[model samples]
Target: MDFKLEFGITDEGKLILADEISPDTCRFWDTKTGKKLDKDRFRRDLGSVEEAYQEVLFRLLGIN
Candidate 1:
């Protein structure tokens, strides 16, 4: 559930939200198993990195 957000100031001094929110840029875990389903898999040298990302996509978009 942890994520990162970026902010930027415009020429008119207006604060704007920047940056993309995705599995590649944030941490996602399974509530039941506490399994990582983000980029951390690749960082930790865990196998099935592709499957992890696909799981996220399926959970979000209901796709297989």
Candidate 2:
């Protein structure tokens, strides 16, 4: 998975750090096999929506 870090300021005047801010930051896997799925492949085989969603999930998980 492609990973990235972001820094920002919080409402409380504190520093906030975030990992994986967008799609293409992680790889999806089969729940049973734990095998990672290629997002590009999914996009080519499926559609843009699925790929975008998967990438968002990975980014939220902070997977590197």
Candidate 3:
């Protein structure tokens, strides 16, 4: 599941966006394979945890 990226205007008229849009805030998964692609991997002792985080960052940054 993905967290909502909510935007709001504060009482002082300041713009704010809640949520980091990172794996820490989202429970991503490899849908077809049913692999956990978030921090749960680390907690569950699954390999490739770093790669999973990197994948999320790469996608967020639009990097190849």
Candidate 4:
């Protein structure tokens, strides 16, 4: 299954995972530098984001 996760950075730059997940959405940056991150080319460069999410889930679950 595909899902989305929101990660928030703390005041000290620590990353925290929020407790919500959605399937029909992913993340995007709304700035020039963010644009430079090439999110729009993600599908071409990294396949679907859903595939990436599955890899992450595999690591998180110690499945491989």
Best by TM-score: 1
lDDT tens digits, residues 1-64, model 2? 5455778988898988866544455555556665445565565665565655765567568964
* Residue-wise C-alpha lDDT for candidate 1, range 1-64, written one tens digit per residue: 8998999999999999988888877899999999999989888987688899889989999785
Alpha-carbon TM-score of each model against the true structure = 0.84, 0.30, 0.64, 0.33
Residues 10-58 of candidate 4 have per-residue lDDT tens digits of 9999999965543235444324443312233365574565555664466
lDDT of 3 by residue, 1-64 (tens): 6665878899999999965777877899877788888998989989788898987778778997
Q: Which stretches of candidate 3 lie over 4 Å from their true place?
A: 4-9, 13-15, 58-64
The better-scoring model by lDDT among 2 and 3 is 3
lDDT for model 1 comes to: 0.90
How much lDDT does each candidate structure score?
Answer: 0.90, 0.60, 0.82, 0.52
Ranking by TM-score: 1, 3, 4, 2
Error of 2 at 60 (Å): 14
Best by lDDT: 1
Candidate 2, residue 23: how far the Cα is off, in Å: 7.2
